[model samples]
Target: MNQEDQELQTEKKGNKVLVVGASGLIGISAIEAFLDAGWIVVGASRRKPILLSGRTLEHIKVDLLNKEDVFKTFQKYKDITHVVYAALYEKPNDLVAGWSDEEQIKINDQMLRNVIEPLIAVGAPLKHVSILQGTKAYGVHLHPINIPARESDPRDNHPNFYFDQQDYISEAGIKHGFHWTVLRPQLVTGKIAGALNILPAIGVYAAIRKEKGESFSFPGGPSFVWELADADLVGQVLLWSATSPNAADEIFNVTNGDVFEWRSVWPALAKTLDVQTGVDHSFSMAAYIEENKDVWAKVVEKYGLLNHDLNAFIGQGHAHADFAFAYGAPQGPVAFVSTIKLRQAGFFKVIDTRDALTEALQSFIDRKLLPPSIA
Candidate 1:
């Protein structure tokens, strides 16, 4: 066999990576992406994930917040060749005030440090570290951020765990030989149960609202343009970031390389769900979903869905709702970031937001999580 074939065969038989935050939306998608590419993946999280496929994933329950738990976990995985740190800690209150919360910094910083310190302390065979970040790094939460936010733009003068975590990794690099890369993706859509993922969130939202005979309404205030990144695509980019030499010590903004206004996207979601969309309606999903938890339970039971807890399904993911349904003050908020750095770094993969959103919504239906939209 040729050299490329030999490498493929070798990976099929032996490549391994330990993905932290394995139960999360990004972590779960990253797991599938890596496994599809022939990697033997070990998934670490606070609780074991209910995986649709584990052909190559070894799930381990780990608490990154607890130092000893973090230490003991890595001690058992000395064979990990690459580390994808997708883990994050956001307290319940920080959801609304993360831009100014102090705990957001402390906890998230420690979580990142906990993972790398343990493995590095044991001198594991780690080669590259890939960290999953989001547009929050651009300070979009505080307000409507700069249009087409570039990688070289100045910090948003806000308090964020992304900075704390990034600084931790950078500091470690000064003393360690393992190179690292950072991937900042906009709203990532994917299927991960019990986690606050956008696609499933949308599926459940539409399914519940449609059944109630309420015409689909855009929840956020004024219309504003935004971006999206598919979970699977982000996973592939994470892998590329780890292996690509140009990615080291660099932060790349990732998206589907597309943009849309919520008003325009609303109709598409309505058509996909087979619901009749109506005028824009500004309301807090946090309040709406909470008040309608019993309504969601009926839909889940009626549809034989994976989750019965509306809070777990929607309440916990309020942050994602806040982002998606955002119609913040001083005019509607628009979060636009440039992916030129990622492209310039040699990774060409992209996902069109419309198709990405539809694909994820369809996946929700295929899995019986949502009843097919009315004809």
Candidate 2:
């Protein structure tokens, strides 16, 4: 067995964990990962996570944007030993592409303050705070990021809220005698109901295009290399970050440690959905997916899928597509982040990019969240 496998067997579990943002992609996956490892978990989100498995946790439906409500709600859970903060506040439908310097920084920073400030005030026995971040923290969203991006790279001279949250946690950790870990994962993928999974976004997009007798075409610009991180892999890493002796007070860049070009990824995605592959026809996928709303609904009904409505099945296909097809950079885009630091710190988990994507697609089909289509 691998060293990680052996370590997991002997590592600690049953610690009380508070996972905020428990309904989102990262949050839900982390909850299940912690549970599978035998942690007593309490999940807090705006609503209960849409469960696809038998496992459940104590869920608190308190909005992080509301400080008073957050304080009161967390006060009852005083025995919390660690926190995995995957909470995020984004624009309603266009989370990926939506960014405003002044407003976003202010609001997101406020939410972090709300969650931790209250916990500190209430004297919760929190030992660690692990915050979630992405390449946006490295300024990839605004421009081409550094090749083989490392954790020690200087913070992006951008107005991303990641810095705000990281800064807050850093100070709090010093003052409150706790350690903080920041995890920056690339393009997190998984099957999450009510959360946007890029694989299903690709599946539905191809399904719509194929239903029109059109081949599944690449809808964005020319191919660019991207690092894809599996949600479950990230969850496992989060657990490691919280419990590992060497993972304290560190920032790590995480990916599946593989690279893919859209040229191959698009075909792989089409094949997963069992759809016909098409040529690269560059256009605004966000707008294209928006136009196919009625058609996706028909696919849901035709296959007797779990969702009656397309929007209910896929949370933000347009945004996921828009963000995935990041093409506005002046130079060719390569947004791969180095996981060397994470590996050096003793977390050796790895995820196969194509396998992760296909499994997530198959899961949606088996659950009837998506229909089985033709390749």
Candidate 3:
């Protein structure tokens, strides 16, 4: 074990945790992580999960969007020692460009005021409340000054709902007397029992292209860079934030230490799948969609897919092709907190990026969640 892992092994452990989004990707793994550390976990989700396996775990049905449900849920579990808010109204695919700022703000603000504040107000024995914020909190469309974004960096000039939500949590924690920490994770990829993720989406796309004997090309420019963090790493960071004194009241950027361009990742994934990878004739979203729309339509029809509206299904507008292509290209390194900071403070656990990705992919396959083509 490295210094970070050693330090993590020594930190004080909390007794019970309330995971708000226990059914989501990050929440699922985080619940398990807390349980592994001997913390009693109470998971709240709109639907009871069929795949979660744990004897120490309890499940509660609560609608976070409903203030009454939020309050009732907290009242039921006021003795919980920690809280991890992984639930959000949006999904990763919601890339609609035409969404107005006011619409976004109203929805996010209500969630915080209705759900977050009540939990803090109850002021049970809560020692820590960890909120899972994401890179968009910094601004969804703004470019970062530094590749890896740090917690202290100035947020983008454009206001976003995530920023407002973070502000509410911070202020509430201060007034309600609980230690609060915000975890800002970028492009989280991991294995989930009954959910989809970016990695799986990419893998399924590649598998379909291969079955059709189509060449795969880098979707966008080669200059775009993204820092990918495994879900396990983010889960560990969440656990550490809730229990480690060093993380109290601080915001940390959780990301894979290494940065890679799509040019590298696309080819690497293609090779792993033993398929031909080539650039598309046109990388523009408009052109690609226009060209492949028929193909995708046929696939959806053949499979009898329930959610088949590509634009709405993917949460991108007609401009999705453009955003998809643009996000694919390497932009720059996203700045983030060095594990050294946490390690030096006596929390030392680091995840190997390659191992993390491989394990995540294998998990998809093991769970039979891989698309038929890939299987």
lDDT of 3 by residue, 1-375 (tens): 899666656653446788877877788878877777766788888876444453446888888778887787677665777888887664333544423356766776786576555655665776788887766666545555544455677776665676777787778777777788887776676776324355555544554565577876655543555666777778888887887788888877777767665666665566555567885543554444545656666656565544355543322222433453464445533434444454555555666566666566665545544433343
For candidate 1, the lDDT comes to 0.76
lDDT of 2 by residue, 110-221 (tens): 9888888777877887789999888888887677678888888987887778888888899999999889999999988888754556666677777788778898877776
lDDT of 1 by residue, 1-375 (tens): 899768656644545788999877888888887877777789999777666674545788878889998898788777777889988776674465654678777888888888898888888877788887778887776666778888898977878878877788887876787778888888777766555575566666677687788977777766667788888888888777766679988999998877877777777777877788877777766666667767878887886777666656553565567557664544555778888888888989877777777777776677767777653
State how far residue 216 of model 1 sits from its true place (Å).
1.0
Better of 1 and 2 by lDDT: 2
Ranking by lDDT: 2, 1, 3
Error of 1 at 35 (Å): 1.1
lDDT score at residue 352, model 3, on the 0-100 scale: 57
Task: Tell me how far the alpha carbon of residue 58 in candidate 3 is from the true structure, in angstroms, after superposition.
Answer: 1.4
Give the number of the best model, judged by lDDT.
Answer: 2
Model 2 CA lDDT for position 141 = 66
Scored by TM-score, the top model is 2
Residue pairs in clash, model 2: 274-374, 274-375
What's the lDDT for all of these models? 0.76, 0.79, 0.63
